[model samples]
Target: MDNKTVLQFQSLSSLVDPTFWYSLTKEKIDNIKLSDVPLDIYGYYSYNSLQSSKSNDNIKVPSFLQLNSNSLTNEIIPSFSFPMKGLLKNTNTIEDFQKLDKKGLFEKVSKKIWDSILNGEAIKCPSLLNQFLLISFSDLKKYKYYYWFAFPALLLENPIYLTNTQLLSDYLNKNELQSLHENYQKLLEIPDNIKKGIPGYFLLKKDDNNHVKVGTLSEWEMFKSDDKNKTIVGFADPCVLPNNPGWLIRNLIVLLKKKWNVSKVTILCYREIAGEYADLSQCKLMDIEISGEELSDNLPKSVGWEKNIKGQFGPRLANLGPTMDPNKLIESAV
Candidate 1:
């Protein structure tokens, strides 16, 4: 198994040297031995284990009456994930880092992560991390900029399931359901009001029982059978800007066509964005509908978007649907 290692700085001053962070590459990172990485203070604790420990400790003693008070108050040193070696293939310079620091980009990124944690959106592996290198030229005309790299820690995973039938059933009462449906319609009427856009794709497949099962790309990667029988459902949040959804769908279609035998392609999006992509690709378009029940399963256990109340559930459903054979979709379309 490939070792997954992350880099840590003992102090912020270490960042003063631009080469310190930017020079790291996949080769260098992969060459890193387990001994090179700092040991986690609490050892490796899975999400459930950490929660159980906290519960047990709380039950055993009162907060003010703990025997090891210092342990509870000790500050956890802040650390960021190092970019995976090959992931950011761009060559960068030290001057780039210096300029970014001067521009306060580091502080801005730090604060963004801090604010997220404060709002209860815990960072998690691969999800919280940006796999790309952000290069900012110092001057566009002069062609100068800095290379800034941030590797968020592989935090405990937070799993979110859109298909939590109980949770969905309890949360969406008749009135709430109607309001949700109405809100979806309103967005279709006036998409300008949707400021925050979500990017995701869907797949529709039939299980052995022939019951339709809806899933996301990530889920399909895990559960898809070798046989070709699937449909690709392209979706974008209504609030997403017009150009982005079309671009995303086009990219998805190209990617799916290359990897699988996709049959028919269908897009569920706002009318305006749907129209834009309909001409670009040979696919079907459907009205956007928001339903908690339809999208109750095969969702990431936890996502960064859930940090906001508005992003909790409704938006997720509209973006996810049943799984289908990608090859069949492409073949059928062709």
Candidate 2:
């Protein structure tokens, strides 16, 4: 056959739908090459319920099968036909084939075939016919959830696979694993500086009237005599701060100054040294220290500020009435 005719036959043969088999003709069956005949024949018989039994007379036997009638009867025909007939006897639809418990079904089918082979009732063609039966059954089991996780991974361009760390460690030297751990630690640190436009670090203070203000130095110019009335708090690591400082400061001013009306916002430091702040202002102090490894392990559960205010950032902020006033933002910063 020419290339175009071969391509057309292939296109029709690949279809598994019952509609393809019901419309088959004797001339079309005769024209297909002998090697490609088995697939089409299997497809036709598997979906044979869509066509009446009387229509089988219209389909011609392939020339190769007619020439080797004894071999076809002894092996090839039984290999392709019986297992499909047995499977279809129990299954009504494609979904029935997919929902079958594969392990139990494989054991049951193999045992029956083995018994027939041992009794000399049916000839076994393990390299040919028997292989086809086992493979076709396996395909039916896989078609159900084949693309469940794969489709999302393809779209995201991040396919994840399960790995055995112990197997991988056996192949690598001890020094390589230590180097990998050190590199991981560097990745987790908060950077000292960000891009040029953003500020590095600063301190925030809560005054007697419960107003939050920011300044470059730890000590603010406006100071009161009573130590109990004022609170001093230090903030650093701007690289870890989400959104710009202007946006964050505006949200904090609205939340702390206007909404909560609190005298102070305290940050309990983890994994850091205590300071000598005698010269600085006296304030109510609470200290809780934790190791870096413990902080890393517990960070996800302890931090939830992002979940509460995520919608208030970026373009979504427009939905929240008017933006924070520029004059009030300037007043909050020294």
Candidate 3:
């Protein structure tokens, strides 16, 4: 298949309901802690450069987004000011905001103050008249709150699998696994190097007609589909491992084991750090030692190979080799 075909096929699988996505989005949005907002927002109002110090971790949002208490209140449609002002700035970045940095951000906000944010005790500060620029002017649109705090939950949902016994059993009884099996068979028939296999973990279902359905993109597809514009970060030998990658990998395992009874699953890493971290027993990981020579080899040209780059197959194969950057190799695999 050509590049256009590959990209079009990828877009086909990624389609999802905007409404359903919004529902899932709103649940987490409602839980955002007031303190998880940005310090610059306070700067907009109080003109307090000191507010910048509120971020204990030096976290901030994109330089463009203007955050102000009045605007935040209007966006969230809250009746009061937030109790944990320091915490918002403390856990400033988009990622940090997701977790709300509860303990750290709210170290100063007393329970009473915290409750008030939730209870709407703090009224909108009139001093910040310029709030309209930062917020939706219409009361109806005012509910469009920005909660970086809720992001982690949404991210967590990104890799979510339908592993509940009932959901899995029903989907499988309907032919979900069979479809993947068919796809795998079709993939193997492709004539080429078959360079990689990045198996995405997901719940499957098979129907009486032997049709297969997937809860989400296969493991290979998820990582293979990483946006080309974004820099894909893998753990390098030079630094301590980031907590998020480990958590992400662990979640993948949990999803597979719970949904598909995937025991003794193997995950090969293109980098030494990934392999090293996989060595940890609690993580129940494994490593594929990639060397410089192995990384330079080209992928196979085959029918299934066509989709592999668009999916996880290329990266998986790349992980088996060490020298090449996994993300770069996969992007070029096609």
- lDDT for every model? 0.26, 0.22, 0.23
- Give the per-residue lDDT of model 1 (tens digit) for 1-334: 1232221111000011222222222223454322222111110000000112334533211011001111112222111111111112222334433343322432343334334333322112111112112322222122232333332221212211111111212323444434433433343242222111111234434344323344445454643444654333534322222222222233233233323433234343322212212211112233211122222112112111111124331111111011123444566677
Candidate 1 colliding pairs, count: 44
Q: Which numbered prediction scores highest in lDDT against the true structure? A: 1
lDDT of 2 at 24: 25
Per-candidate TM equals 0.24, 0.17, 0.18
Q: Candidate 3 on 1-334: residue-level lDDT in tens?
A: 1111100011101111223223322433565423333322221111001112234534311111123334223233111111112223333233543444333332222332223223322112111111111110111122222322200100111222221111122223324444544553343343221111111222223334566433322332333222321111111011112111222133233223333334333231111211212211111113211111111112111111112335542211112122233555676785
Q: Which ten residues in a row are the worst by lDDT in model 2?
A: 147-156
Q: After superposition, how far is residue 128 of candidate 2 from its true place, in Å?
A: 11
Q: Which candidate is the best by TM-score?
A: 1
Write the candidate numbers in order of decreasing TM-score: 1, 3, 2
RMSD of 2: 34.8
lDDT at 198, model 1: 13
**Which residue pairs clash within candidate 2?**
none
> Which of the two, 1 or 3, has more lDDT?
1
Q: Regarding TM-score, does 1 or 2 come out ahead?
A: 1
Distance (Å) between predicted and true CA of 29, model 2? 26
How does residue 23 of candidate 1 score in lDDT? 24
